[model samples]
Target chain A: MQYGFFQVLRQVELAPEHFVIWGRLTPPPHQPILPGSFLHLKVDPPGDYRMLWRPYSFLDYQPDTHQAAIYYRVVGEGTGQLCQRREGELLPAIYPLGTPFTHEGVSRAIMVAGGVGVAPLLMLYDRMRHSSPQLRVEFLFGARSGRDLVPGLLEEFGVVARMASEDGTLGHRGYITDLLPEVLEQGEWQMVYACGPNPMLSALADLLPEGLPCQVSLELPMACAIGVCNGCNLPLRSDGGRYPRRLCVEGPVMDLREVDFAALV
Target chain B: MGGSSAAQTAEGFSLEVSLGPLRLSSPLIGASGCVAFGEEYRRLYENSRQAMEGSSIAQLGAIVTKAVSLKPRGGNPPPRVAETPAGLLNSIGLQNPGLDHFLAELAPRLSQLGTKVIVNLVGDTAQEFAELASILSQKTDFPAFELDLSCPNVEEGGRSFAMSLPSLREVISRVRQVTDRFLIAKLAPNVCDIGEFAQAAVEAGADALTVANTWIGMVVDVERRTSRIGRTTGGVSGPAIRPLTMALVHRVRQAVRVPILASGGAVRTQDVLEYLIVGASAVQIGTGLWIDPMCPLKINRGLREYLARHRMSLGELIGSFQAEVSRGG
Candidate 1:
């Protein structure tokens, strides 16, 4: 439940504001880090102002090396401080919390990401390849500009990457939602997994075809990253009503149909 | 401390605690609101088998459902909760499936649990509380009710009734007319003197008391220069609020004769013991269950081990450590 020595093994600057850091954990020998699950790190130089733990989803995992990476955006003081840390420094973490993405009985999958929301999707990509190579995967990445995209990461996984930027500097000029119509028409995606800004997710929810399976990863200010805090809750539409369901316990990855996007915001 | 004492008869392990007419199987009960209507964690109860199975109905010592209202409420805006130091802040805006829906949907689910569900009722007015209690009492499945007097009076422009004794007493008295089911009044931490409110609720026929709910707190988004929670202010719960909960529980226990169910910061067996020593009949694990799903099982096991080691039954320890207040020690 609690991990003490999961230090940052390597840090790669993906963009000006976004950075990818690989944390090499000394997990109890036989234990393996699964994709979609996250780690809660105790912020060093603890003070009254910044005492709570920070959570980051596992972006990629290498079981042979015992290293896991997280993609984080410098959004707050805690993340800004985390971004500044160099390699070899020790950071205490509580890991692999919550349920992971279900990879069984899937022949093809489509992954959608926006900004730092791409983190979990990348992990899913790797895990699917290793777990079931027959699983065909494609990724659609949306960012503000072409510079924000993580160059050939999707291509390395043999995934067809579709780039969309807000500005006309990349593939599609408008939102990721603009391309959804065309993507659905081209291929039969068995399952659709998306993680991005709320607006993009809402748009996708509306555009999604019926009977096709879809799941989304949401972001919330997490304290314990475990279920107790009740900090992360996403409203789910059930039987024509909405209820605030705990995201950490019930799900961090929920079926799209079950989620009430209108109730969430 | 004889190994085969005649006093330790064939009941296995039993402790009788009273909450008005209702006699609990043991002093250990789940806190209201923390555990859902008992049906929510049915899978967990099934998984743990019967060792961890507390009565879904009366298993909680008494069940406290999440805050309910007269009509269905949609609750607050997005980003309803955020993490705090040793705590969590939530602006759930009291999102409930409405009284009618609960009566129809949730009541059946709760009834199947085989435990008395203590509906944690909340409203903006005394009339509303009375109406809710009246409707709940009429239902065949409904067993007991706990008026959440601590809810911030949004209708009165955001003033909590639990902060004032007279206001809380009036609500309890109004609900008493409709329901003979045991009434437990839950208190709020946003008050100067909780003893005043506790005495008033007891006088107004409240059978028991839930020590406290979340305290008002806020987290700021420095970049946007705005609060992180959708509703700028929220109730703070978890380990950060445990010590304060203990103080209130201890004070209320001294002030009133009604049984007190200690909530707030109970995450471990030691914390539960601390509350019990201070005169709490049972302790509720709130935020602790969020961290470790098996916390209640762990705490229950630990308490059993503690009681066995002390060579004392739970009844012998209840309110046995009270300290009389004198001019000096």
Candidate 2:
């Protein structure tokens, strides 16, 4: 459950404000890093007493390289400190927490991401590449401007990418859902996976064609990525009505149908 | 040397104690109302198969259910929990599926756990407590019941049953009539002296005691100029309160002869050791489980290793320090 910090082997600034760091975890011999699981990073700065730990989902897990990547925005003090971590620094972490995305029975899929939500999708795209080469995948990434879109990474996965931004610097001048209907009409997709802002997810749930299986990854403030805290609870839709479900355990990725979006939003 | 080595040396002389009729494999039971009802982390349990192979609810001393009541509670509103120095402040308002649903839904699931399920029952009045206890006693699988007379957030005379001997005795006596099952009265730390309450419960036919629920606390939002928690007050827990909890446990142990299950502020194996040494028959890990779901298993492993290293068994260690106290060593 606890992992010793591997070195911050590389760091890249994807945008003017965004950054991604790759840490090679010293996985206690025989531990294999998976695609969608995350790691809780111990980013307590020396002599600076504030927050305890921050969790970031894994972007890429290159087991051969013993490297894992995490993409983050400079949101607060914790992220700011994490961004400042230099190469060769040991960032103690708890890895591969929570269930990974289930990619089965689907031939073609569409991934919808808003801002930093694209991190986990990148790993999923890589894992599915060889197994389903002919799988048609469309990635719709939304941001404020073209500069916000992560360059070269999506294309390297051989995914057809569409960009949407509020300022019109990207492919479309509106939200990601503005182009979803057109894309779905054109492609014969079986499933859709999305991770983004609450509004974006709400819009997708409202507008998406019914009967298409959709899974969503929800982000909640978590002290422990594990289920014990019961901090991150989302209302789940059952046959009768909604009930509080643990996001950390029941899922970080759940079938969109099981979520009571109305209650959550 | 680290505390683990010291713990190893001390574990050799633990003892086997009984909390009423329920016997334990080891006295280190997961704290009631801390860990959820069942195993919530299937993946982590599945991944660490070796560590979790034999130990779970089935192997543990006992598993206590979260506080249940006759009526369903919505609980408090958000900012329910906030991090303190080395502790956490929470005012969950005892949100639980009502007693009927609990028996129908949760009881069936819990029956599969293979461990003794000590139901932590809370109520507004003595009548309600007796009624619920009566209903619970009728169930064939119900093992024991803990009267949570110390939940701080309830508006109807908050923790009044715990502060006074008369009310505490009346509540325990009323419930004891309906069920011959083990009755443990959980106490609150906010009181002036917890030993008085422990003595009262023991006199009322209570089998054991769970020392201390969270100490009431509050935090302010500077800009909003209001309390952080919706209820304006919350219960504080975690490592920060270990010293206070240990003192309370020791005091209660001296006053009462019944077994005490030490809770509140337990985060590490050493903390567990400290409780056992100070006359606690068992220890429960609470806030630590929130930081790491696999923490209980880790603590269990660590405790076993500590005992093994010192060539001692857990039963030989309980109340071993009490002798030192009596002799003034």
Candidate 3:
């Protein structure tokens, strides 16, 4: 984990209750930043109201600018205060935290995201793009309704994009699960990655055909995202045996076959 | 009280202690459920300059990792934690990677750190507990196994194993047969008579005791009309639980001859000293680490200064409190 003090270079609202924060952090000597890693950041501590470390997924990073981007949804008071933080405000954050989704040696893959679960997928998509052109990728983005959806987010990734909204606000009117079978039918998917709330990921885990490798990113209230506090844990699927893995350490993303959907959510 | 000798005063006070079979370089071990298997905290310690300066992380005598079981356990559902006034209520359901993987991929890494690795184990039955201990006995590297009977997170065996005397004896006796390494029975503070349970653990062949685990606690969100923590209840640990746990540890020390490791509400050096004064051989830093990852070092600094000032080692401070009808009144 790379721990350092970073300055808030930029912050903006992406959608209702969702925002992106950009910070310039220098990795501690001998440590390298990896994709899919997270930042255990501290919200401003005001008086006796001590704050706990909040985990943010790595949205995207630019080595040239020495800045990393994080996407967060205002779930609580800590995040609510973060959205109001001004530019040049600084906070301490631990970088390259938790496990990253591995996208190695795959020629074809599809990603499914729900709401702000799109946080980590954006960086994973960038890596997939920089990889050999032989690798074909498809992006499927979904939300509760049109207002919750980011217009033209799929276009920036330059991949074959599809969309679905629960209220028929934008694309096909249904959950992302309804759109999956058709995507898997069009091409032989070597890998599948999903990130968002548990229900969305669980539904995707249910739909993905057997033998298809699916990795899901979990979102939970993590106090010490470095694994010390057992706040964020994911139960492994039926085949994954009985132990629950800590999301802060072992994963934020794990194979869908291993996540015990019924046990966790 | 004896006067401090000049020679004794000149020497650097040691934080060393012998908890029966285990000898620690410092009386500071990361509490179970708070410390991870390895790498997660170490990488954070190594990468942060502030956490590395002046004092080192090695001062952490050991780490008692989150509980592991014979088979993997899918912990309770989300909303696992609720922030209390100065404490945290958590029902993280003994979430672990199971025994086989811990032995194969994890235990080896624990030894790489310059501290003891005390693996915590739990089970639904005595046979399962024995199987877990048997597997770890062969590893040779892990110095101890903490039989966790105080967790309030699970649903199957809702009542704690240590809550009843017979069950505590039965589980400890069975697991004792499998491993010769130091066996520490981690009991609960919620028991009706903690002293009786302490004697029960000692009689069952526990070499040492962790006095104790988090107290069962709950918080309700009036506006939401739901319990703050998922699973409705959790074990509370933090500054809020400190005094109550100190009393428990003090009582357990008086009842049992075995060394005691204090688990709850250890946030600063003064808290560590207080536990030691009341007869805790060591103190486990729990939820405090979440507030500041460098808590151990900061506490170690506070402890060292206190030791140097009084020219007393940790041993001298342990069980220093006297009980009497009058203080020479």
Candidate 4:
């Protein structure tokens, strides 16, 4: 990980509530942006110095140009401040942090996303398609409404996502997990990669076929994005016999089997 | 921005200050629990060119490790932190790898950091505190111990130890008997009169006092209608607490003759200066490290610039507040 400034190249409104900021790293990222890795951007004004660091997943990255896009929803103050940043503004950030998803020994995998959780999966999908041409990747994205879905952004990457919305204004009326049973029946899946709200992830974990491996990107409230503060903890399964993992380092991405979903409640 | 009569060069600048018999190269220190055992901060500093360009962790005077206990602690449950206006509320519940692990794994690594390491000890009882000092004194050459009598998150002995004079004195005195090294009693900010605790600590043989720890505060999720933190309430830290903690430092300085190591929401050079002018010998950076791990270097640079502009050395600036001019109330 490296601490440096990223000059804002552009800010685009992907949807009504969702926004994406494309920034060019000054010193550039020391390490390549792995699938699950993220950037902790200081969103508070320069002089405020309140340490309002909010971690955002990379929506896309151009290694040659040293530019990347961070997709986020204006949920709270941190993201609320981030969305207002204009082009040419320099924002302080730490990049390529947290353990990346383990994509080894996977030929065919299903990518599940809930709302803004689609951010990291886009990066992962691009990676898999480029590295292994024969690999088959399916994208199942769910949101609160049709307007919240970013099929336009997905199309830019040459992906056509099977969308789901709770309001029935989009593809399935109920939830994305509802389609998993039929999606699993279509082919033999090697791995499941997911990122989303806790309730959705818990439901996905329950719906998964037994012995199927799943990698999930978890979110927790964090003070220091580095490991020292011990603020963001990813509780381990009760039977796992391990201490709680610090999300800043150990993961933002973890195996669904190892995590204790019940304890998270 | 302002012209200076005596602008000192980097070579001529001195960030050194003394905390009683112990001397520090710089008055800035990494507060306990914030920097962990120094390894993580060291790694971040050494790796980042931005951090290295200005200064390194070596520029800091010393670092206080996270609280060490006799046995391992599981710590608090999830949702352990919440953000406030200009601060953070955390209930880590003193999660540590126990004393044996600290000595074996952490202590050896600390010695290589090129900075003084002051062990922060917390215990359920006075005997536990003494035993921690006894074991650490026998095993490591660490120069000082900051008795953490005011960890607000813990339910049992930790929360109330610093509030009550008898327990605070007993812990400090027991640790004093075990080691002659510099002992700093870290008091709680949630107190009736901080001066009383400061006086008791010195009378019981503390060489210095860390003005205060984080004050108890809480945050709630309106949607969930539940506490944001795991334990419902946690220690509130950052710039929000600086004014209150600075007042405590001023009170403690007046109550005791020992040197005071001020720990609060010191994020900038001016914050450090405020503590020093208020009569603190040194300042500790806790949440500031979260803001910028390299803040010490920036503060160190700012200190030199300020001193040069004023044509005053660090020694002259310390305890220079003119409270005597104030009329009696």
Candidate 5:
């Protein structure tokens, strides 16, 4: 983990209330920036809003040049304030936090994302593409409506893309689950990765083929993004045993089957 | 950030604290639950700029592990924590990996950390408490045991043992027989007289006392028309309960001779200094640590400045607060 102030090179409005914050972060020497990891942005809310810094996922990172970016949505006062910052501002951050998504010797993988949840998966795809260019990959991106979809980052990724929107303005006219079944039927995917709001992740977890392996990035209201807080707990179950796992260290990305979806709101 | 600082004071005063056989480099501890036994925060410390600044987790006096038990507890169901004004209501329910898993997996790494380890133990019965103590007594690495008496006394119809004199004595006495290590009985603050509970545990051979645990609190999400926590009520911690706990520390100081390890709402160095003034030999940082992993380091830095500014030693401040100040004419 690295704690330092990174200069904001640019901030792009991905969609309504959504943004991709680009920071000039060059890690120390020989440090590997992994996928599904996050950085805590200490956005000092101007007034008495009661929130400290907040956590956002690494949208994409370049190892050679050592540049990193974070994706965020204006959910509350904390994040809403962060989106208002201009470029060239120094943003304090704690980086490469939580566990990363690993390729686990799979020849093929499927990714399911909802809105800003697509952030980490993009980085995962970006990094994995280097090692396994021929590795078959499919991306299922979803949003509330047409205006909310990120413009063209998907087309530039150069992979099979499947899109969905609830308002029916985008690719498939329904929830992401509407497209998941057909995507599952398309190939013998070795692994599945998902990230999004709680209900969406839960629905995807429930919709997956039982025997297939899947990983999910869990989100909980947080304070200190570090493991010390014990605040963000995702109750999990595997092999009939149920327990709570802190998202900070154990995972932000966890096995989909292990998550006890019913345990969280 | 500074060339001149309190942590750099060169004088006769020292921040070190000694309570029975356990010695602490400073009075602040990484309260259980907020900090993992030690390893996780150690990584955070290592990653932090404080490492280059010449500060580390080693500066903390000790660490109390989250409540461990004889059997593994999965913890409370959904919504284990709820945020209140400058505090939180938590119902973690002492979730742990059980004795065998802890000793085999986490204990080895925890002992290796260059800080004192005070294992917090919780059980349903006095015998259960003693069994944990007996088991831990054999572990040479751990220097102390903190009895989490906030748990329900199943032997006495579900009221917390810390709330009843007899139950408190029975549990403390039973654990005392098995462990020669420093025994700290953590009492609760909700009862009518916290001092009475403090005295009872000491009489039963408690080496020290953790002044009080979280206060009983309930927060309702009125719009949703439901309890905030999955458990209807949970323990309230942070600045909300600091004053109430400070008073309890003062009362416990007057009632007993054992050192008091103050818990509950402590977020700042002033809170720690105040607790020491009210007779706490040490202070534990819980909800605050959850808010920031670097709290102990920040507080210690502030404490060194405080000691230097006042030109006083920590021992001079212990129980030094004069509640009834005389007005000079």
Candidate 6:
């Protein structure tokens, strides 16, 4: 974990209420941010002294330039303040937090994303592409509409994703689950990586092929990503334990089978 | 002010405070549940290189651990917290890894850290509270224990022990008999006449009193027609409760002869000073850490600068509130 001022380098509007922010770390992280790790950015101003910290997974990170990008969909007051920030302004943040994805022995994997949930999975794919040249990686991304699709980022990643949108403006019409059966048949997949809305992730948990290992990045609301405030709890299966695990520390990435989807309320 | 002592540094400034029998190097304390056995903050400090100027845990007077119960509690279900206007509402329900786990796994690491660690205890009955205190006192050489009297008493029809004077007296006196170590009674803020409770706590053998715990509050999700937190109501803490708690500290001070450890909303150095001026022996930073983990460091530095600028000792600043009388009333 590292805390420093990150100056805004650029901000791109991916869609209405969706954005990609690039910031330069004043004091670069001690270690490169690993795939599935996130930065806890304080969106509220410094003068106010009332901290409003939000955790955002890395969309992309540059170790040399000390530059990092994060994708956010404006949802509340914290994200609202983040969107209005401009270039050259610095954001106070704690970096490389939470447990990252563990893809040690994997040779083939499919990355499934819903909306801006594509952020962390992109990082994991980048890691796999660099570390294991022989790895076969594919992406199945879905959004609400064509405007919500991040074509620029996908192009930058050099990924031609099998896409889906609810309104039929993109690749496949309806939910990503509609295309999952076909995608599962196409690849002799060793593992699955998914990130998206809880409802979508919950559905994916039920739909995945049995015995297929999967890691999911959760989107639970959190305060003090350091694990003190027991706010962001990930409910686990009854057999796992009676207590819920803290998503900030225990996960933002967890085994799909371990989470209790029905008990998430 | 039984053990309160101040040693002036070469710069002629001091941050030391005494809470009855206990003494500390600095006046700032990490409240219960905020530091959580000190491991998380220790990891952060080690990773961040202790970045902020003097924000090390070593600089704090003490840290109150999360509530330790007789059995491990699962806590509330999902959505344990909600952000309000400058405050946070939480229903964590005192989730802790029971006494045996705490003493074996968590307690050992606490002594390794330079700061003083105060265990926060919660139980269903007065005897249960005593049992926890007795075991901890024998097992660990920790400086003190803070009683979390806000828990509902099963023996007394589920009413909070802190709400009724008899229940409050029974719990404190029971624990007081079992241990000679310093004891702090944490008062619940929801009751009427908070000052009266403070007096009852002190009379029942509490060495000091943590002015109050989080205020009871609720936040509704209008769209879903349900509570934002897992529980119907949650404890509220942060800047929104700072003013309210500071007043509680003053009121408690008025009614008690023992030291007062102020706990509620203390995010800034100014907030700490306000609590001290209103008669707090020391200030505990709770949700303030969520805002800035280095707050203890920042507040410590800020306090030093403020004291140096004023050329006053910490003892002089505490309970220094001056009232402006209005004759018309």
Q: Pick the candidate with the highest lDDT.
A: 4
lDDT of model 4, residue B49: 62
Q: Give the per-residue lDDT digits (tens) of candidate 5, residues B169-278.
A: 99999999887888999998878888788888989999999978888888998988889877778888887888888889988998999999998777677788899888
| Candidate 6 C-alpha error for residue A257, in Å | 0.5
Best by the DockQ measure: 6
Candidate 4: lDDT over CA atoms?
0.85
- The digit string of per-residue lDDT tens for model 3 on A1-265 reads 7566557888868777878788887543245456667887767643222456667887777777668887777878778868877678767667777788898887688988888788688788888778857977778888888776676454455645587899998888988778888889999889998887788887887788898998888877677787666677666655353344678878887887777777664
DockQ for model 1 equals 0.18
Interface quality of candidate 4 as DockQ:
0.61
Give the CAPRI rating of model 4.
medium
TM-score, each model? 0.71, 0.75, 0.77, 0.96, 0.87, 0.95
Q: What is the TM-score of chain B alone in each candidate?
A: 0.87, 0.88, 0.93, 0.94, 0.93, 0.92
Provide interface RMSD per model, one decimal: 7.0, 4.8, 3.1, 2.1, 3.5, 2.0
lDDT of each: 0.71, 0.73, 0.78, 0.85, 0.78, 0.83
Residue B211's lDDT in candidate 6: 75
**Going through the candidates in order, what is the number of backbone clashes in each?**
10, 9, 8, 0, 0, 1
- Model 1, span A1-265: residue lDDT tens: 3333567777887667778788787543234566667777655542222245677788877777878877887777678778877788776565566677787877688888997788788888877877786877767889888777766555545556788999968888878778777778777789998888877888888988898888888776665465533456676777354444667766778888888787666
TM-score of 3: 0.77
C-alpha positional error of residue B143 in candidate 3 after TM-score superposition, expressed in Å: 5.6
Model 4: per-residue lDDT, tens digit, B237-270? 9999999999998998789888889999998999
Q: Positional deviation of B102 in candidate 3, in angstroms? A: 6.5
Residue-level lDDT for A178 in candidate 6 = 81
Kindly report the fnat of each predicted structure, to 2 decimals. Answer: 0.16, 0.09, 0.50, 0.54, 0.31, 0.57
Best by TM-score: 4
Range of the 10 consecutive residues with the lowest summed lDDT in candidate 5 chain B: B1-10
lDDT minimum window of 10 residues, candidate 1 chain B: B1-10
